[model samples]
Target: MTDQTRISVGLQFGTQPPLNTLRAFLLGARAMTLDSVMVIDHFQNVFPTSIWDRDLTWLAAQRDTPHEFFDYQVLAGYLASRVGRMRLGVGVTEAIRRHPVLIAQAMMTLSHLTARAPILGIGAGERMNLDPYGFDAAEPVSRLEEALQIIHLCFSTQGPIDFCGRHFQLHSAPMDLKPARGRVPEIWVAAHGPRMLSLAGRWGDGWYPATVVSPREYAEKLAAVRAAAVAAGRNPAAITPALHRFMVVAPSEREARAMLDTKVVRAFALMAPPSLWRQAGVDHPFGERFNPLVDFVPGRYDRETMNAAIAAVPSAVVAEGPLLWGSRNQVVARLRAFGEAGLRHVVLAPVSGLVSPRAALYSLWATGRIARSLRRTSPGDGTSAPLLC
Candidate 1:
């Protein structure tokens, strides 16, 4: 006997493709009932400039800039018309760049267009998205807390909203758009820290953490979220337990593990805080007291510095970076273990695809197989989204 909810699988492309390519991609996805398609919002990426010139990703050779990103909100609006029946939204966008009221309005608009419940994934602003553009990255949790309050106020009521807080102040701001008749928009917060986790419980429809945490640690953090929900007099069950995970699938376990030593993969590990690097007896290039990934500025590093830093990262460190890797069976087993830890929804990113077209094709196929193996569904359940299977 098991108490697992009907788990949903979602696909999240790490980068945006050309308009025609994206349209065709979604056309294919329309055949499956995937829970959601999440777009990443970023001005700069986690990968350093050096990797862009290498064979890390196919987009490298075609790019005008090493770090190029289309506006996620605009892309979401375009996708609303194309994604046949699946939910569509950005994985996480901060209120730091866009005002909280605007985010609320955008969610309201998308709800009317999409056939399924559209999700609004929020997070404390990332440094790369903020620092270069002159936005204050300090007290991000506090700012996000206030932003959530404002956005929540706008959605939960139809009246004028007035909120006074440390990071934001709103005076009788009018936001009067209602969601589709029966479709309610969801807010998935990317929370990992203690204060952020509590906010996820109090305000979010889903606790969508992107960090790499052990299943045991996920259970512990999940419990904290539930406790916070209970303290707020809300049903803890209302919040979907969701995660954003990176995976690598190859012909063999050895090949998969070997892929972790690539420039992009090594850079991914470097995105982790110095403490994680320290645990593996590796020195973080940015220094022991360096800020976390969310606070890191990737654009500032010269190619030489980035290459040196990435070279410093060992494959073993990447393996223990908490990223999922291995042959198909190993990957599936790990996902199943996480599913047992109350993971109801997950957005999977296959990073090995960056290595080559062959790796990408194999990973794509393996992902479908992996999804079919782990996601349980009732027979004849027409709503079951294809996990790429």
Candidate 2:
């Protein structure tokens, strides 16, 4: 593929930064002239809510914490109304938490408010979000598949929607609200595994994967999506290949590395299982001895214990993981590798000492630099090229 392949770069609003801080961050991002902005969907904090109830010390420590989460749909709508140019989206909303019909309606509302079709990113479900809310987490893939059908129907068809599925049933469900100018918002499916990849290719307009993926693995998964699209009689090139990456950028490599080697980053690295690391061609130091992916449940452990566990993770492992951390040129080279791997879009989540504004601004600056470089070198191949926006 030529540089005519347009790469859409955006920022992912993490699970921290209260509404005011978030709004300021968005303003700063807009000033930097980014392409799009995405917020995450979570009913509670990204951390396990059980932690507050189970650990008094953690609760006490949080008495003055500014780490708060806003509903992504609401945030998206608000941002759409305020931000003049940038596209707005939710990183990934679960089908289990909200019915697909409602999800469609929400997207329609956002589209109308923004005067442009927004992207609707969907995923199966996460146990952390589901189990705590008393929702059944079993058979998530099947439920998500059914939900996708319902959502597609709602967006494509007019009048009453009627559907019957294992997890959901709708009888003449009236979904009259349409997207702006009849432009249906793109449904970007967040998928990683084989089945989800197939689902994304078959039904979704885009494939949105997490930051844990390696460049090689991303190419492999993108190929799977393409093959599935071909098998489904759809154009493989039509589906957008997108990634959500955690990024830390600073003027100096030492500063960036210092920000990256923290408890939160370590915990995030440990959350991925060894099998996943091996799949990405990294040899995880702690194999079965520490399986946070399978064993660590949020709210089950105290903050002290969790910190201890995160501290035990080898710094080398965190350094070698999926995170993008370095000076501007280093980050650009890493991102270019993903671009060569056929990634058409990137959503970055800036990580720092509890979502510090200084770190966020540095990241936005770095991202702007990357976006400019991509656009400048982009060849005129008679195809739409990436825009900085």
Best by lDDT: 1
- Give per-residue CA lDDT, model 1, range 1-389, as digits (tens): 04474456777874455677667556645545566788888887776675577555665876645567788878888889887778887888999999998998888888888898888999987888898899877888989899988888877777888888998888887788877877778899998888999999998899998775567777888998899999999999999999888878887777976787776777777766455677778677877777556767877887788888878876656776557778877766566566767888887778887777798778767766666665654323222322211
At residue 115, give the lDDT of candidate 2. 53
Clashing pairs in 1: 33-385
Q: What are the runs in model 1 whose C-alpha is more than 4 Å off? A: 1-6, 15-17, 377-389
Please give the lDDT score for candidate 2. 0.72
TM-score for each candidate, following the candidate numbering? 0.92, 0.86
Taking all chains together, the TM-score of candidate 2 against the true structure is 0.86
RMSD of 1: 4.1
Q: What is the C-alpha lDDT of each candidate?
A: 0.77, 0.72
TM-score of candidate 1 versus the correct structure, residues matched by position: 0.92
